[model samples]
Target: MTKHNSPLLGSHMSLSKSTNYLEGVVNETVNQNANTFMIFTGAPQNTKRVPVETFKIAEMNQLIDYHEIDKSKLVVHAPYLINLSNPVNETVWKFSIDFLLEEIKRCEALGIHLLVLHPGAYTKGSLEQGLQQLIKALDLVTDYESPVLIALETMSGKGTEVGGQLDDLAFVLQQVKKPERIGVCLDTCHLHDAGYQIQNWPEFKNNLKQLLPLDKVKVIHLNDSKNVCGAKKDRHENIGYGQIGFDTLVEIVWDEELTTVPKILETPYIDNLSPYKKEIKCLLSRSFNQDLK
Candidate 1:
């Protein structure tokens, strides 16, 4: 059995739909005995946002403090509607930039510093054009100085998504004007789907380091894929039941380089119930739950 340096383990908790919203998020994190968590300020699919004051920040902070949850690792995900790579339409691209900027402001006000964002799809344009547009959008949004850091999430290459490959992300990082405000969020399922051999840690790490630096990986989405490697589908399964097996995921969770980085589970629910409590327990115990399904 291997031991971790008390890694930050948590899941994507709800912020808007629950009875207590933000407080419920903190409570849910505590329920699972997690040290950090992620949330969307509103719904993930919509642009509609409620006033930040209504989030009950004071109450949420008190709950976080009481539970000794690491506030620095708390994350907020941008709405999926934001597409920074919409090269075909200027209107859509501008809207995406504005929405992302607003989300960053919201995160800053809430005292959260890390924001996870999908790099977005090109749809009707070439990958090169999409990458250019994405770089431009990021530059525009990060022009202002804020404590909030935007983490570009690795995509599953399901469609015309921009971040399915490391070269694309590396190019964006190299071209982006505000490097200090940008970072990366590595999702295990996405990497596996995009055809990266994540199960082979050494080879994958060597290849990854050749293009992207480990320090830029601010967060990790600890998910198991329902599809096999190189499937290009983004379906997520429970920890041990999916293609990316339990032992591999456990290895990632305890990886020395990512020890301080936050690991968030976005696994599918079983029987309309969250499997995080059990999943987190299993990961901490450094063993797989045979009956997790």
Candidate 2:
């Protein structure tokens, strides 16, 4: 659920690298004066997670309250290796399903209600078959009943990755038994890299309304791409420093169709967290200036 009062903006803060995983993620967000962001429960490429103790949960909730960030609107990115579309290896496929199902439970436990997932690649099968498997996995996870909203992320179309096309995401949702349990998180870099022009938010919104309604888009990975549109590159650059110019990025955040959804930065990291702070400052200042006009 989005808050219409302000633009929900924040970045992906790393827990693995932080000295204090739980509190550090929040502190980093507060350091940038951002209200919303995404986190990998563990490393996205590896299936490892820090054991969440009771104290961590209480401390995290305290910080969330102190910072005034809503828990429901928070987003979690699933691991990179969890691939539901692996048609060749049954074991890997099963692991993907199990990890995802467990991921929902973990989110529920922590009171984080939204989880973003990459619809996996079709490693050894056709796109059609891969989508079917993906849908099946989603159905199983949400089969019983779960409050955690699983958001399938838009991909960069790298290699045989399953969900670069908006239509592909829509199709997968159409087949899910519990459609209400799922949502979509559109990544700006992925959208541009997958051949859609980032400047053309109007057309994109029109298409979204026709098939996957804007209401179903709960989160946006606000990023600038290092590569040009249609380059199939997944590189993320600091906002205003990449192919997505600062002015265009301003236009992106101000787009009315996207105003209500939460926007997150998956931008490159600066060791001291200076880069994120600067990016957040840039977004707020640019948008504030637009209000004066």
For every candidate structure, what is the RMSD over all alpha carbons to the true structure, in angstroms? 2.3, 3.7
Question: Candidate 2 lDDT, tens digit per residue, 118-161?
Answer: 89998878899899889888887787587889889999999999
TM-score, candidate number 2: 0.91
Against the hidden reference, what TM-scores do the models get? 0.96, 0.91
Candidate 1 pairs with clashing backbones: none
lDDT of 2: 0.80
| lDDT (tens digit, per residue) of candidate 1 on 118-138 | 999899998999999999999
Steric clashes per prediction: 0, 1
Candidate 2, residue 204: Cα displacement in angstroms equals: 2.3
